[model samples]
Target chain A: MTLKKKQLIECQSLWKIFGQKAKTAMQAVKERNLTKEQVHNEFDCIVGVQNATFSVDEGEIFCIMGLSGSGKSTLIRHINRLIEPTSGEIFIDGENINNLNQTELREIRSSKIGMVFQNMALLPHKNVRENVAFALELRGIDKKSRDKVANETLETVELSGWGDRYPDELSGGMQQRVGLARAIAANPQILLMDEPFSALDPLIRRQLQDQFIELSQIMHKTTIFITHDLDEAIRIGQRIAIMKDGMLVQIGEPEDIVTDPVDDYVAKFVSGISNLHLVTAGKIMQSIAEYEASAGPVKEESLLKAKLDDDLDCLIDLSIKTDEPILIESESKIVGIVSKKTLLAGIQGHWNT
Target chain B: MADEVKFSILDPFSAIDIGIADWADGIKEWATNNREAIQPVKNYLNDVIIWMNDVLQALPPLITIACIAIISLQFAGKKVTGIVVICLVAIGFLDPRAWDLTMTTLSIVVTSVLISAIIGLPLGILAGKSDRFEQLIRPILDTMQTIPAFVYLVPVVMLVGIGNVSGVLVTIVFALPPLVRLTSLGIRQVNPSIVEAAKAFGASPSQILCKVELPLSAPSIMAGLNQTIMLALSMVVIASMIAVKGLGNEVLRAMGRLDAGKAIVGGAGIVLLAIVLDRITESFGLSKREKGVRHWWESGPIGLFYNQYKKLN
Candidate 1:
């Protein structure tokens, strides 16, 4: 945990109070340590983001998950200064974003970061080609080259040969792809996606999630993906930050958030999510030395061998076929062992690795 | 001149005198006194009207009709183009001089509509962007639309005097409100998320206005333009009272003598003119809707042509 990665975006104690007296309200809250509800009652102000702090590492998908009014979306907007914070500072690659002037902020938005929204904000008047090429065009990229780049980016999103059609001509799923294509067309260093696929049907949402996961690996762009859907967060996010009432409840890996949520709200949010697909063997496995000392695991060949990162579902499937405990391996070296009892405990969120 | 004595037109709702002949007379007197101050504006307005008239007169009737037919066919399609051709051809054959009359009315309408758009669109964009501006203009547009057309003409006649210049000025005043209102409406109706998207992508205010807001709101703005043109055409007959010659003059003269056939013919010409302008402008406005449908004719002739051209390219 102490081994720090290169932080691309670090937001410190960010607060955004949305009201006529937002600045005063924010000052009062900081001075008195007033709760969000207390500030609302005292100042008639609604807090959109409150004391939210998290860092997204380079090439990591940092997800913010919460319901409609959870401020997850509001928090991500601060990174690009779309919603300017009333107090606190945001640093993108160690440069404080809040201190930057309008021109610098715009430069960051146009060149450094790309954002996709829940509404799939493709211009209706623009054809798919023009829509995808818009960012490049804004940067004064030549039409011939930008169109080629747009076509290539569209193909990357599996939307080739659909460039000539307007957004209204495409299906909702196709439109979302075009949106993603547009964001990536400029080849920005970071991406901010605000529930980009929440409006889609579950089947399509899942498909896009899978594609995004693959795309993230190839593009390696630091992404702040906001969603209310826990399943989507678990599927794509390398780390998840859960927000409630404009405050960060917990920020952890999907396993940590699901298995060891810091509060009742987060626990409740993750209650319906099955750890079978989320929880990994490494998270619930007994230490290799401890297992060998107690159970005499001296054998080189094992019938049931599972990767440390293998989900509980795969471990369960393996355990059902045989009475032997599953051997957990990491980087081709046996790291730990997961017994059936541990699997049950892991399912019940009681096991601690 | 003898008909000027009949000034007591009564309202069904009330017996109050709606006539404002005295106000017109007073304004005229005031205008004459301030003639030097307004001379430059009056001269500029007259020059614009004269130029417009000369342009319309310069083109051959057949050529003008052919151009209108092609332009109409391109946008509104075969149905609208067919209607325009039939109506204009009927006018040409029925009365030889009617071609010149049609051209004159067209020149006035086109000039006024262009001027209305020039003034109205920027006002509409301002109103669309600012709540205060919208509130301020809303009442003014209401007054402009609701005021009796003939009543406003009195002030117009006083300022610009009579002839095609006065006709153009009056038409511009009458036709302006719709374009302004609709442009505001169009910009207001733009999806907030799309505007945010533009902002997120680092578009400047002007870029957002031009690239996102204006283009997205174009349908509504064009709709406003259509209404303005229709209103301008309607003003022609009224404009004829100030010696602005056109089909309106024919209609006014025919109506004065109670000549039914001539009145009907003049009215028909105006209707045909309206259909031509309405359809062409409407096609531009409905282009977005046309994009949604894959059918060739669903987008009208202009859309079909554009779609095919895109495929070929």
Candidate 2:
């Protein structure tokens, strides 16, 4: 969440079209009075992704949230060239990726980026291990080595010993966990998930979001997670980019986005959503000593409970070693204590800008 | 006290006529026409024919049927039992001379089917790839199929004369439509998503067809092949009147002499052949699903082949 802009994968003025004559029509726009919409109408090309741009930093869960056909999918696809950009550039680790050949692009895809499609797109034919091994297999890794890595990756997603099961055999959440394993197994520097949990039940989705957040915590893969639900974006994303009709309407941390939306589209999304889901380690995270902790250390206020998914009640009367230690009170006793500097430093990157 | 009407392929509609009266004129005209179309028809009836005379003549009735039995054993296994038994019984009851004529009819039908399949599959793929070609060929297949089975013989008899070659040729014309229609339909019905999946996996167009489209549509294509084989069988009897030997000739010869016993035996021979042909082609479709061979290219025999290919490459 504290990853910097230099670590960001950035998109600049991206446009994508769904038609054969896209290039020629875009050219016509360049030469004459034809506007983008005019050219689109004349040529029967849809401007699915239009002049969109955003940045997602390393370790930040950047979510692109929008309704179906709002170009959120098209824009996310631009990151990995599943759908190519009609115009503009995408830069990952300061390298522009639009001009790569098929081989070069596939290499980039195998190493630099991974994707979990909305449908999970688990090769219907392969069992869990094989699906997880797909990107590695594409990279020409031999079966034994890829299988070993796949098992380890499945463990990381809490799906150990499920390596032999088929995607259809697993529950939707488990299948998604397998899908997430497949994406993360390659250890791609950037992970792209297109509404991966949309197909799961609400209870399962919340569990998955928590699981994904915990997994990302350790792996630190720069994740671009797409979803339509504002609550999902606010809960899981460190920073969220709300998209509408092929444009990025706002890009900010979840709390900032909820409180100060840039447009009516984002405003409408934020209004009905529960603000509770937006509370994360980065928000509602106080400098432990700054709050009144006279009763003792109230470990419930600590970011570890929020970050690690450990029970808040487990931290009762828990002690911590810190310079300039301050007490945190739950009810009548000290639960935990930590240095104010350490608490605040975890939240440093966002407050300045 | 007889009803007289204008000469036509249609029926005379006499009060004495039954449902089969509709089929009567076409056969009568066909017989009259077959005698006139080729001078050799009369000669072949009384003398030896080359492919028919040599191939069917060299094999005794027992040996000829034993070959069909062996083929059924290899391809269809247990299902061949009833067919083999029925064939043996039918051959036992048939007048001995008619067996050679029936084998000739069987030979032509099998040969024409092979030719139709070879031609139809490629043309189907062509139609699948291009809508323009499909639109152009659609009506031709329609006309080729819809023109009555007996009516086609009149024209083919004119072109090549009433002989064994023309008989087989006419069978091809009648039976080919189903092959062409089914192949194109199967290929066209291949899943779009699967096609995209193959392309995304870097499969070339030919690879897509060989691996994805063709295997998935095998059932449909097999159905077409089955129907074509049936169509060829149906045409054999009509074709037999014109010096095409086999069961059709036996049936016609029996009808000429008014022998119901000979007619039933020949008809039974045709039925046995039809069952044998149907089972084999149906097995060809069933073979894919027989031993859990969905996506066969992934593993099993195909995977072994791929491994060998990789080594060679």
Q: Output the worst ten-in-a-row residue range by lDDT, candidate 2 chain A.
A: A308-317
Q: If you assessed candidate 1 against the hidden native complex, which CAPRI class would it receive?
A: medium
lDDT of 1 at A169: 74
Deviating ranges (above 4 Å) for candidate 1: A1-3, A277-342, B1-30, B288-313
Model 2 over residues B77-138: C-alpha lDDT tens digits? Answer: 54564567576656556666556655666667777787789888899888877899999999
In the range A1-353, model 1's lDDT, one tens digit per residue, is: 66777999999988899998898898898789998889889899999988888899998999999999988888888888888889999999999988898888877788888989898999987889999988888777899999999999999999999998889778889999999998988899999999999999999998999999999999999999999999889989999999899989899998889988898999898989988888888889998677678778646475589998899899989999988888889898888888778888888877763
Cα lDDT tens digits, model 2, A103-213, are 777677777777776676665556789878877776678999999999999999889998977776788889889878887787888888889889899999999998888
TM-score of candidate 1 on Cα atoms, chains taken together: 0.87
C-alpha lDDT values of all predictions: 0.86, 0.71
Error of 2 at A26 (Å): 4.3
Error of 1 at B301 (Å): 10
Model 2 chain B, poorest ten-residue lDDT window?
B287-296
Where does model 2 exceed 4 Å of error?
Answer: A1-10, A19-45, A55-61, A79-84, A90-115, A120-191, A203-223, A277-353, B1-107, B148-169, B238-244, B252-261, B283-313
